[model samples]
Target: MARTSGDDMSAGATTPAARAEALIRRYFEACNAADRAGLIDCFTPDAVHYFPPGLPSAPWRSAEAIADGWVWCVKTLGSRWTIEKVLAGADGHEAVIEWTHWKTSVNEVLRGDEWYIFNDDITRIIEIRAYYASPVNKADRVNSLHGFDYAGRGYHLDPPTPDLD
Candidate 1:
């Protein structure tokens, strides 16, 4: 039996799952290089991205909405975004990715996962969401945009305590 375009992932120049992964890689590469246009190009015009920490109840519903919000975050937050792991679904429609956003000052590091749902043939990302966790710091005020705070008095900032609570 001959394989269809979706069936033989290796045969074609474009496969749904492969394209999604490639687009994802390019997105992060552009982020690392600070290419705003390239970053924006990865999404569909109607794509939605949600910063889970910032808005637990609401999500950025459009590319423009997300871009407007991303401006400030990118300006003050200096970091390299990289995918640590990726698992593409067998259906070639969705993927789960483990990624890291590491910053220099305060040596802040956020480890997270993203779930991507492609719009068509992985060429456009229709829905993307990320969830990450980092240590809490008192000086964290200047270091974070999320406004995280610790309650205890013995709190130390040198090496932030893990979020085991």
Candidate 2:
């Protein structure tokens, strides 16, 4: 069963993990409600949301853009989301969650996992990388987050050379 925003701890007063989880719950509530202001409050001003290839807007850069995109989804697609699980890092700077997005209007659901990078204070999300539960896109040479600077971000670009005797 998926969890709702009101199913868990309050956003204030708790461990880092609880706080992060609460914030995410609140963010999803805002998204389902199509509350633009509320959505914007959950992220840093320069926050970015990365999506897998094939999405019209691959990377939604900036908090405003992210909020706008979600609002659009809710309004157009009757979008609602549920958090299946959340795992916060011990350091509290990072967390990951599994989610299911329901497009009620179209009767479609998308399941995915999102890796979140929180700001130093752990108050707002600075980055989100979404990975969908779908088959690989064979058409794309490199199936990864579109428009993301993987190289600049120091992500592994190529596999290490194998050592064979």
Candidate 3:
């Protein structure tokens, strides 16, 4: 089963994976806030970060690696991360989380969703994979004051309404 995050602002239990996800969310927020230390807390010291070619390598193979790469991504993107969805589970010792990243750049919005897929059973992230696309024609655009302005940069969460689906 998959689930979307950003809900129960005041009446929900914070599971371990949930805390991890929250930390990940705050990591992005820290990037936006330009708080270097805060962003580094989201990853393991030996964490490995991968992105498409031509993009700089985000390797958190060590604490220093995390610091270096995390800073670079924050600076390079010139943007912050917005998690549109997050689903977490466990395998052996790993907690796996699948999620979507919404970002903006030069007034253009982009959407990227990933299934953190792999042998990440030591923590809570099972796998890591994603897909990104344009938001120019999305149905929500008409009333989206956020506009075509990078996806989720200035966006904040509204309490989750009853899930009708």
Cα lDDT tens digits, model 3, 52-129, are: 333445323444565566466455644445555565453332323433332333333445554443234233223233
Mind giving the per-residue lDDT tens digits that candidate 1 earns over 1-165? 112111333324365566666667767655656566776787788888766655543587776665554544455655555465667765557887866565644357565668888875667678888765444444553233254442232222233222223
TM-scores for every predicted model: 0.65, 0.77, 0.52
Candidate 2 residue lDDT tens string, 91-149: 67888887767666665656578999998878899999999866445454344445756
lDDT of 2 at 19: 72
Worst 10 residues of 3 by lDDT: 155-164
**After superposition, candidate 1 runs with Cα above 4 Å error:** 1-13, 55-58, 68-71, 133-165
* Candidate 1: Cα lDDT at 99: 61
Which regions of candidate 2 are displaced past 4 Å? 1-6, 136-165
Cand. 1 TM to true fold: 0.65
What lDDT is obtained when candidate 3 is compared to the true structure?
Answer: 0.44
Collision count of model 3: 20
- For each candidate in the order shown, give its overall lDDT on alpha carbons: 0.58, 0.74, 0.44
Residue 151 in candidate 1, Cα distance off native in Å: 30
Cα error of candidate 2 at position 147, Å:
32
| Model 1 local distance difference test score | 0.58
